[model samples]
Target: MENTMVFEEPMTAEKCSGHLSSVEDAIYVIGGKWKLKIIIALHENGNIRFNELQRIVAGISARVLSNELKDLELNGFVKRVVHAEQMPVVVEYISTDYSRTLKPVIMALSEWGRKHKKNIREDLF
Candidate 1:
């Protein structure tokens, strides 16, 4: 069994509409200035505290980070864990299984961005 998304051939208006809707839904969940960045940071760093995540994401204000985290959690891409067992309670954010589904998409986007940057630099020079 292959673990991948496969679209059937034969282009039709209905199929295109369905595809567009799927894309839009994905964007709705992850489309924001800081969502993907926050996801990438959590993905790379494992569980992290709010302040640490803010530092890792860089340039995102505390309020924005908090809001983004809440959004991500609401969308099922992130998990918030509150640790009240220890002397000092701690809160951490971790990427959920659903967030892992975006890995390929993110990598493809990153590749495209790199190529786009190279093209821009070449054009400028």
Candidate 2:
């Protein structure tokens, strides 16, 4: 079974009516189809340029990647470094200290994905 780590508790009337916790906001920022993927990609590569990141994480469109990068930067999980070059400078996305907190979450997701894929392949075969 895939044990994906969720950032929010069970949504109930009480939880919904009340303010979300910091953990909840953290989850909200990093909890998405592509948000975590971006984090992991930056982590593995240390620092990567915008276009390079778009290429590494397949299937994410340019607009979505750009928007997510902005969100991550806004949430302080990513640091955007702008290089001072000639025409058409470069911007690199680097993982911030806040992102390190999701290390265990990433580990769990990786293990779950590996197990789930193996199970699927086994069933198919």
Candidate 3:
């Protein structure tokens, strides 16, 4: 015999509302044209300078990237470090441990995106 888990109680209004609030919070943090892209680049490259990150996250304007970095830093998903000892001060961005929690979410989204694009292409043909 196979064992399976079943929900003993259906989700109540309170539970649904709580779930929605949590999801909305997540969306507010990570929802944007370039947030995930920036995160992924940082994860791949480790700590990187502003101009290097701008180059890696191709197509994003300086203003938008600057804004996005500030938002990510504020949200605790990224760390901005500065080195002032040198004649030329250097600044870099690093992905926080909190941001690593999104790895599974990013993987799932990547898979879903590939499937979605394939489906759309099939439909178009």
The sequence of per-residue lDDT tens digits that candidate 3 reaches over residues 1-125 is 24654557887899879989999999999998999999999999999999999999999999999999999999988999999897699998999999999999999999979988998999999
Error of 3 at 72 (Å): 0.5
Of the pair 1 and 2, which is ahead by lDDT?
1
For candidate 2, lDDT tens digit of each residue in 1-125? 45765646776777655546756866787888999999999999998998899999999999999999999999888999988784678788999999888899889989979988999999999
Which has the greatest lDDT?
A: 3
lDDT of each: 0.93, 0.88, 0.94
- The segments of candidate 3 whose C-alpha lies over 4 angstroms from its true place after superposition are 1-9
How would you encode candidate 1's per-residue C-alpha lDDT over 78-101 as one tens digit per residue? Answer: 999999997689998999999999
Clashing residue pairs in candidate 1, if any? none
Candidate 2 stretches with Cα past 4 Å from truth are: 1-26, 85-87, 116-125
Error of 1 at 106 (Å): 0.7
TM-score against truth, every candidate: 0.88, 0.71, 0.88
Clashing pairs in 3: none
Return the number of clashes found in candidate 2.
0
